[model samples]
Structure formats: structure tokens, C-alpha cells
Target: MHLFSRFQFRDWLLANDPALSRLRMASRVTLTILLVFLILLAIEAFILPLPTAAFGLGIVLSIEGGVAVRDKGNARQLVTRLFGCAVSLVVVAIAAGLEDQRVLSDLVFLVIILLASAGRVFGPRGFAIGMFAFTSYFMGAYFQPPLAELPEVAIGPVVSVLVGHMVRAVLLPDDWRRDLLRSLESVSGRINQILFKLAALAASGDIGEADRQELRQLEDRLKEVVLMAETFIPRPSAGVFDGASNPAAELAIRLFDAHLAAESAIVLSFQSPPPFALVHAVIGADAAELKRYEGMIEASKDQPQGETVRALLWLGEARRQLTEAINRGGACGFSGVDAAKDTAQAQAIDFSLANPLLRSALQITLASAIAMGFGLLLSRERWFWAVLASFLVFTNTNSRGDTAMKALSRSLGTVFGIAMGLVLATLISGEPDIAIPVMAICIFLAFYFLQVSYATMTFFISIVLCLVYGMTGVLTLDLLKLRIGETVIGAAAGTAVAFVVFPARTRGALDAALARWFQALRELLGAIGEGKSGFELIALSQKIDACYRDVTVAARPLGSSWSVVTRPGQIRQTLAIFLSCTYWARVLARSYEAPPADDDQRRLITADLALVDDAASRGSACFFIKRKASRTAGRHLPVSREGARVGLEMVGSALERLYPQADTLPFASGEAIARSKQG
Candidate 1:
């Protein structure tokens, strides 16, 4: 005992070491399961029949199975499990009544399973199909008792599952409300950090390469955090037990918009480098003001002063603009420029009309129909085969990559599970006394390792199933083989159904994303030309981010369709040039302090203004041209750096090439020549 205690202490120390902490998380999870299993055993012995406990355990185990493996929303998981279990139970009831026609019933069950699997191939549409398939197979083949016995078989599993979910929710360290609040506060903190950094750079009158890189990384991290927060909010459709509706959701959105505004200001600052003296003075003042406001926000949390909090929030926002101006060489200075005006326009630029819900529904329906049809052709009972098919269908919901992973894992796991089951059955064949304890051990191991890997968990489940069947004196090698074959058939049918029916076209999605990208660039340029600041600029930045995400998500499915949609690559290249030009225009804007009377200063100012107008016009034209190209086959427009001197001309040329048309030309010959003289 002393040696064991010493060893345990040493292991704990190693697990807690910083380098090994990740391993500790998994270890902790394993230990938690073991504890839960022990408690479950106790409950079975004292409060319920052993079989009932097993059934409940199965439901509990299934409900928790995918949470650690995939990030399916909690609400979605709950819905899927409830529906799957309910459907399975109903099918079992029906199958029992047809016991007299065992062969016919088995064939029908197989058909139903196939159909259900096929339905799920598309997306959410086939969810029901998969559930029904699982129900039919288990009920028709294994649980061959009377209708009265059916509920008994299910009660244990359902109870076990309910307990498991309750435990999971209770064990969660932080509630959704707290998490949402933290997310908001974290975003606010990030904004403060960015502003402080910008102010420091301005005060120094030198934006080092390191500072610029740091700013870029901060902006990227802010975007990621905001997106993650959005995911944490509960969907409206999630039922009663779902995470509570966030009262602060609107505030979070506002904060996100605010951060975008700050980011835009930073970008503009970089483009239009501010005057050194004014930049230093403004940065110094803004830094002190921002610190004060941050303190107020923190104080408000404890004291609950609404007006104070609002004032602090507004101050923070004001500082964001001031920081932007300082970074841009104090071009716009502290003048109140409304930033929130362009948000609505930015949101209106969605290019793809493909709805997730619609895609999911179609995929599910198609897969189910195919699986059902195949089952019927095989002379199987429609409902039984349909149920089996349903399980396979819902395994993947329009994500081909996810579907492939699940199929591979499920197949491998099933194979290993079958072998384990066979071995277990042989071991316990004549040892009736050891059956219950052995079964209990198998259950504990399976549940504990379910999250370790799909293949391993499946193997564990197969062992449990085999053990149960053997205990009932009905386990056979032929039955084991049959089960394996059915799983393979269902998986194959589901995958094929996904590929053939209303297949999601990655190229079309990519094209739509490219169109959006051009539109975003047009808006960004237009805003800059109009001297957009505050909310408007921030919103534009957010729209750009969203468009980029859309393009990325769409590109993943492009497989062979990438070549057909040249828009993604083109738009990406165009955006880079557009961003550079916008930055330069901002620099020029900042360069305009008091009116320039000197011939050189005046010429530089005039030339920079002309370049800004030219770039904006060209970008606007390119947007329309891209839209037109998407609607109809058109020739690619070629652009040339006609009279540009300080690289602004090259930027204009790039924009022009994106949308070359006689009527769409944005710059006049005189304006181009005048700007060329200044450079």
C-alpha cells in the first residue's frame, strides 16, 4: 500500500508538469469515467435490475460518445440522441410482432437500415433514417421477446443516459452565462491592448516592424475569439434544457463591431502615416484616457453604475478613433467622424445563397430514399433495413470530409469490436459464474475509452454486445459475421448515396465567395475615399473577414472544381493590391495637416488625393465587372500603369485590369497626368 501510494504521488506530479499537462487532461477524463462507472454499478446493484442498468448505461454512453470527438453543438447532440433512441425503440416494438416470419422480417429490417443510411448522406435530412435502422436490427434479431419485454430492455439504457447527461452538465466548471460575459470582457480587453500599442507606436513616432507584426497577430486573434463566442450562443431551436438565451448577445455583437472599427483605424493609420509631433501628443493623451476608461468599466462591474459604464464604453470607442488618427499621422485628428454608418451595406454583400438547412434536408432525403430502394431490391423488409440505413445516413451531414473520417473509423472500430466479442464469447462460454462480473468489466472499459478513439470504442461496444448475447446463450460466430457485414453494407451505401445525389458543388460556392470578395474590396475602397471612420470602417473590416472565411470554407470542398473557379485566386491577389493602395491613400490623408502653400507640398497633396480617387474608382469598376463576369461569359480586362509614379499608378493599373471596360474606366487622362507630376 505504501509503495502504491508513493507511485501514485510520483505519477500525479509528472502529470501536472507543464510539459505533460495535456496528457493530464486525458488522464483526468479517464479517471472521471471510472468513477462514474463505479457509481453506476452501485446504483444497478441497489436501485435497479442489472439489465435495466445496462440499457441505461448504453444510452448514457451513446449520448456522451461524440462530444469529445467532434464539436457538434450540445443542442444538436441532445436532439439527435433523443430522436435516435425513440426511433430505435419504436422499430424494436414493430419487429417483435413479426417474429413468426423471422426470415422475412430480417430481410425487411436490412432494407430499412440501408434506406436510412442513404438518407443521411446529404446532411441533416437523413437523421431520422439512421435512427430507425439501428432500432430495427437490435429489436428484430437480438431482443426477440414479447412487446411487454421491449420497454424493459430500453428502460435501463434511458435511465443511465439521463443520469450521465445530468452529471456532465453539473460537472461543467463554467455556465454559458459566465462564459459569454468573459468573452465580452476579453474582447474589450483586447481593444484596450490594441489602442495602447498604437498609442505607444505613435508616441515613439516610429512604427517598428515588430510592432506592425504584433498588431496584425492581435487583430487575427480578436477575430478568432469573436467567432468562437458566436458559436457558444445557443440556437433558438434548441429546446428547454438548452443553454439559456444570452441577454448580452446584442452587446457582444456591438463589441465585435467596435473591435472591427478599431482594426480599420489601425490599418488606415499604417496607410496614411500621421505627422510626428501631433501623433506623439495625441497618443500620450489617448493612452491616459483609455486607462481611466478601462478602470471605470471594471469598477462598474462591481458597483453597477449604468451611466458610468456607458460613459467608459463611449470613451473607449473614442480612443479607438484617436488611436487610428495618430497611427495615420493624425490625418483625420479628433474630428468626430461617424464610423457606424456602413455596417448595413457591408452585411448586404453576401454572394452565396446556399443555406445550410436546405443543403442538410436535401442530403438526408436523397440518402434515405436510395438506401430504402436498395434494401427492397435485396428482398428485405422495408422498415427494418430502413432503420439500419438511417444510422449510416446521419453519420455524415453534407461534410464529405467528416463523412469519410466517420466511415473509416466506424469500419475499423467495428472490425476490432467483432474480434473482441468473439474472443470474449469463447472465454465466458462455460463459465456462467464469471459472466456478470466479466460483462461489468467490459462495460467499464468500453465507456472509459470511448473518447480515446472511434475504432477502440467501437471494439469495446462490440465486446459488450457479444457478452450480452453470449450471456443469453444465443451468441454465435455466424451472427458476429452477419453484424459486421451489415455495418459495411450500410457505410458503403451511405457514402455512395452522398456522392451521387445533389452533390455539393465546391466550385459554385467558390465563385460566389469570389464575387463577395470583389464587392467587399469595392466597399472598403469607397469608404476610404469618403473618409469613413468609426463604426462604418469597422463594419467594413468585419465584412471583409466574413467574406474571407466564406471563401476558405467553400474552397475546402473544391476538390476537382478548383480549376473552374479562377475567382478565388484572382480575388486573393486583387485584395492584396487593394489593401496596399488603401494603406498608401491613408498615409496621404494623414500627410494633409494645415493647408500646404509651398509648391512641393501642394503638389504632393494634390497628387495623393488624385491617386486616392483613381484607386477608388478603379476598385469600384472592378467590382461591377466581376459581378458581370459571374453573370455572363466576358473577356478579361487588361490594365496598365499609365502615368503612376510612386507605385500608386501600379495599384490603379491592377484595379483596372480586374475590370477593364471602356465605359467602366474611372480615371480621367488629365487627373492621371496631374497625379503623375506630383509623384
Candidate 2:
């Protein structure tokens, strides 16, 4: 695809990176930011730079400017985000109206922060809106004059949003929907190709580890898409044809699992003419033929010596399920969320005062306020940048580690920006014509990469500021030095506040989440045994995946496993049991499934499942509350199947290993044995 080709660029822009690969955003933002610079340059052509900069700052307070909106996982559409920015701009205008009254202005400022900090209820979007409003309060107050200047004060932000909407609607095309459809189609097609290969393997009575790994990778990607995809009823295709949400990939996932399960049954049973080989012969047949195959398998289940017939019967059933799933893929009308569950989820996000949001809001607001206070006490010119540094630093930070890293990134970017800014300002010190155009490019690049990296945005914004200030006739060594010191002060204050209040020092949440994950896995094992097949298994898998993500996110801030209560490998090994058990359970649930071949086999299967279930609970208990668990001897597991015995022993051993350390036990080993005997 041509990088500059509008049609080709749309696909890249639709990617889920920080850049979102959205070319429209880049183009529209550049236009808006440059327009701001150009307009400022013309207004301040013969005047000093500081006055124009003050007004320009107020105008660019929308998120499209350097407002620093965080992208927390899933994002709304471009139009939605822009609308949110516009809403925040209204607050900016109101703040300007209240500026003459210091008490009211300060009161509104704190209220904005309080509302923004309600992350539990509003999630990231609400926080972003509130935070933008709060950031604009600084600029609005800077340009405060009297009630007469309301139009002038309101014009900057209002124009900011208006310009954005015009550029988005009139100039650039939004291709998010088209790109998502293309991606879904491509993934689903590739998955079907894999399913065909698995069908061939089944027909040939062969199974390879490499093929299984490919299915596993497919499973992982499918899960990732489910969690990351923005749920929306897509518009008509190409603005004409009918369309559906991206359920094609999800349906392909189910088909892939079904084929994999069939292969497992065939491999385990090791029977001649592996089940569903006949179905594979008619791989591309229509749904009617697949239904007939399912009926044929059902009839075979009643015959004597159906143990081997069972595997083939199950394979036939899987083939039929594949046909059904493939048909469902082409037409998705799923209610993406249940009303009751979605409401509950929204309530949780809307109201929980999670430590992350509460602490972040408190820390950043206090630090910025204090930084602004210090600047007022010193009566310094260009004091707004000081508060900006604190706000930006705290906004980017999540933990002690994140704060340290962001501060470093900020300092380095600032130094380079300042260096470049000094050179550019010196070259165009007297020529507004040259300076304005140069700053225009700086503003364009700054906002263009705003979603890409905070460091990169700050780097260009620094250059823009230097040129703007130079034009203002306020570019000075003292002011530059003051800005750097203020940033450091704010950084220090933010880290200090985090340590002192609502600190997230423990990995307790991650531990609890893991415990819940294994518990769910246990339930899934039971469900599979009961021949259950539905959305419940999918939801369970999603929960397990969510637990892993929680741990990964939690691990980032603390930067160590020191806080974890359980033996890390133990949980992981137990998870391994989870996968194998689920796979075998699924195989047993198939239509041709028999009673473990004989009575001994049945007894062994029951014993293994019981022991594994007991082990899973033990793992969960140890992981969540550090409760000791002990394994009981397995008496009924037969020696016929090497895999079954080894798997069961692994589960039993993992369960037994959950006991507390020897030092935690009061009695010696000999005394413990004596007490056991006496009991």
C-alpha cells in the first residue's frame, strides 16, 4: 500500500496501536494545530509573542491540542473522542467566565478535578474529559480579563472544536468500519484454511504437534481480538451493502476448537479408520449433508462394541458443528452485551474508587496546584508551564516505576526540545514570517504523534513553545530554567504523593484474580464432563485470560514477584492440568463417547477427575489466601493409559505441594506422624 495513498492509508490508520494507524487523525490534527499557529502569527505579526501565546494557549485547550488524553485499552470512535473534547471545552469557557472571581474560579477548578477523578464510575473516558477540563482551567485563567472578553475567551476553544469537526467531516474520510470488516474477513478465511488442514489430518489418521500448536496460536489471537475489539454494530458496507459486527473470527474460533477436539478423540482412541474421516471426504459439502452425517453418527451410538464407533461418532458430530458454525459466521446478530450484566459492569466502573484513579487524581491535582502556588509566590512570568509540567508528568504516571520512567523520558525530551527550540528561535528571532511557519510545522508534528508517545508530543510542543515565546519577546534563560525546575518539582511531588497515599504496593488483586481463574477452570472441567456446549465455556476462557492480563498489568508497577503469595510455577502447572483436563473432557463429551471402555477405565477416569478437581481448589486456596493444601492417594487410576496416570500424578503432586513451609508447622515430623496415627 502506498503510504500517502488515501485509500491504502486507511487500513494502516485503523490499526490498534497508540497511533491507531489512523491517518485521518494525523491529517486533521496537523491542520488544526497549524491553523492555531498560523492564526496566532498573523494576529501577533507586529505585537509581542507572550500575549498571543496566552490567547493561543486558551484556544488549543481541546484534546486535539496537547491536552494529554490517555488511551486506556479500548477506545471510542474518532468522532466520539472529538465530541468529548468539545464538551470539555465548554467547561473551559465557563472557567474563563469565573476567572475574575478567584474564589469561584478556584472552586470550579477543584470540582473539575473531583469529577475527573471519579474513574471508578466513569472509567477512562470520563477521566479524560474531566482531566481535559481541568488542564484548560489553567489556560482559561491565564487569559482572563473581564466579562467583556468572554467572546474572545470562548472563541479559542469553540473554534478549536469547530475546526476539528470541519476537518474530520469535510476533508478526511473515516475508514475504521471498513478496515475492521476487512480484518475480520481475512482472519476468518485463514482460520477456515487451518480447519481444512485439520480435517485432512483426521481423514488420514494422523496428528502432528506442529498442527496443534498452530491451532493454539489461532486460539490466542482469537481471544486477543475478542477482548480488544470495540463492540459496535457496524454501518452498511461501503456505505451501501449490509454489514454485521465482527463475529466471523469468533465463529471460526469455535470451528477450530471443534476440529481440534475431534483430532484429540481420534488420537486417544487410536482406532482404525478414525472417526469423521468420511466427513472429511466431503469437507466442503453443504449444511444439509453435514446434518445427515450427524444423524448417521447418532444411529451408530446404539450398536454393540460401539467403543471405537464412539470416536468416529464424535468426529462426525464435530464436522456437523463446523458446518453450523461456518454458517453462523457469515451472519452475526448477537446482542454483544446482556442488559443486566452490562449495567452491573457499568455501575462498577462508574462508582468504584479504585486506588489507581483516586490516587492519580489526588496526586496530580495537588502537585499541579502546589506548583502553580509556588509560581504565584515567586511572582514569576510564564508560570503556566510550571503547572503544565506537573500535570503532564502526573497524568502519564501510574506507579513509582512509571513515574520514574516518565520523568526521565520527559526530562530528556524537554532538553532536546529546548535545544532545538533555542536554535530555531535564534534563527528567526526577528522574522515573524519565518518563525510562524516554522512553529506551524512544530505544532502539526506534535499533535500528529500525540497518540504515539507522550515524550514525542512534549518534544515538539517544547519547540512550538520556544518559537511562540520568542515571538512574544519573552524567551529568556531565566524563564527556561524556571520551567525545568518546576517540572522536576512536580515530578518529585507526584511520586511522593503516590507513596504517601492510596499506594498500590501489594499484588493482592492479581493473586485473588488468579484464584478466581482456576476456580472457573474447575467449573469448566465439570461442565465438559456433563456434555455441556455453549457460551459458558467461552466466557470461562475469557475470564482466565482476563486474570492473566490483570497479573501482567499489576506486575508492571511493582516490577517484581516478591509480593505473590503462592509458588508461581505451581499455579502455572495447575493451569496446564486445566487445559489437558478440558481437552480430554471435551473428547469424552462427543456423541460416540463410551464409558471409558470398561469398568476399571471408568473408575480411573472418575478418580483422576476427582483428584484434579481437588487439586484445582487447593491451588486456588493457596494462591489467594496462602492456605495449605494436601494431596490424597489416588487408588483407582489404572496403569493402562500412561498419559492418564502421569497427568493424574502431576495434579496430585501439585496439590500436595501447596502446604506451608516446615518452619510454619509446630510439631516435628516424628510427632506429626504419631498424632496422625493416634487420630
lDDT scores in order: 0.47, 0.49
Taking all chains together, each candidate's TM-score versus the true structure is 0.46, 0.58
Looking at candidate 2, the ten consecutive residues that score lowest on lDDT are 631-640
- RMSD, model 2, all Cα superposed? 11.0
Can you tell me which runs of candidate 1 are displaced by over 4 Å?
1-44, 47-57, 60-88, 99-146, 181-222, 230-491, 512-533, 536-540, 559-679
Instruction: Give the alpha carbon lDDT tens digit for every residue of 204-315 in model 2.
Output: 6654544444544444343344334322223122211121233443443444355444444333333233345444544454446555655664565433213334444444
Q: Residue-pair clashes per candidate, as listed?
A: 64, 11
Whole-model alpha-carbon lDDT for candidate 2: 0.49
Q: Candidate 2: deviation at residue 289, Å?
A: 29
Worst 10 residues of 1 by lDDT: 631-640
Instruction: Report the lDDT tens digits of candidate 1 across residue range 416-513.
Output: 88797788788877786786566556555555454345566567767877877787777878667666665665666556655665554444445566
